[model samples]
Target: MKSGFPSTSPFRLPPWAIRLARRQQNSMAGAADRMRFVIQLALTNVTAQTGGPFGAAVFETKTGRLIAIGVNVVEPTNCSLAHAEVVALANAHANLKQFDLSAPGMPKLTLVTSCEPCAMCYGAILWSGVRNVVCAARGSDAAAIGFDEAPKPKNWVATLEDRGISVTRDLCRDEAIAAFQRYQQTDGRIYNARKGLT
Candidate 1:
């Protein structure tokens, strides 16, 4: 007698898709372009799943390597802390197998998020050691779409930059807002525990 079971395999993209991704990565000339591309990728991923309209990606700036793409999975995963930035950072760390993101000489990595990170994600970025952050939308943009973003101090950017993590805001702002608008139009579930309060 023998037991039968399906074998598990690692996820792999088609060769053509990989080539296309590489080309796109190479073509990103500035922070806006890269942030737009990643946010679009994130939107595509999240739209396929049941989650809020937020996405994130991690990229190695020096080599133009697309490290990881993440979509907000909080609603699908039933976890409040599963923000897109957090999920993306976790994926990047796991893929690289290096948790000390701040180590000297580590390749410069940028975290691009569709919206400004909430308080939880902000902390995650600091600890994850990404050297730079690019955001397409501000927290108020998400709040306008009915998502409860945490209250951040007015000097948040300065705070992050002071720690060696440069912050760029409003990259591809219009496109990011459009993504949230589409989600709202589709009646996507807006999971805000403190909906009315914050």
Candidate 2:
């Protein structure tokens, strides 16, 4: 490891990427690398079951590739939208840099999560300046789940645009539902305050 840090291999930092990372370090909630590692860890834990109802996804910013990694299963519930938000925030956090606008290579970051994030997560991502997010839900055909305390749809849409992160969603229904069900069977649980709003 370099300087007691794990190497980010196959994902080298270009000149601009380094600059952007430095700039990002000056602002934001946590170190970009640390946030990204946490997101990956979280996603891994969420998708450990072979037949779980909940699913985790990984987003590639440069290519907009959204891949499913794990799932937490339920009895055919709706949770795609929540998955989308999580991927977006995780991706934005991963892509945080010091000077992306001036970075030469234009290399991108990715976000992966079990489900979409809540409205609050979206706002934080927007404010953080992430521009693209790709997500996968629990089920290929899973509909969006609503929370009793979640924000209105209209507000979510507006704020998403305000943050300037373009979103793309994909369906892997069988795997998603299987994941959710698996989770329930194995007693897997995930909870967050800002998980289903935007």
Tens-digit lDDT string for candidate 1 (8-62): 1022222332333445535354677678776775566446644667877777766
Highest TM-score model number: 1
**For every model shown, what is its TM-score relative to the native structure?**
0.82, 0.43
Per-residue CA lDDT of model 2 for 19-98, tens digit only, reads 32333322122223323432333333345432223323333454433321222222123443333333333333343332
The local distance difference test score of each candidate is: 0.72, 0.36
The local distance difference test score of model 2 is: 0.36
Cα RMSD to the true fold for all candidates = 7.0, 12.0
Pairs of residues at least 3 apart in sequence or in different chains that clash in candidate 1? none
Clashes of each: 0, 51
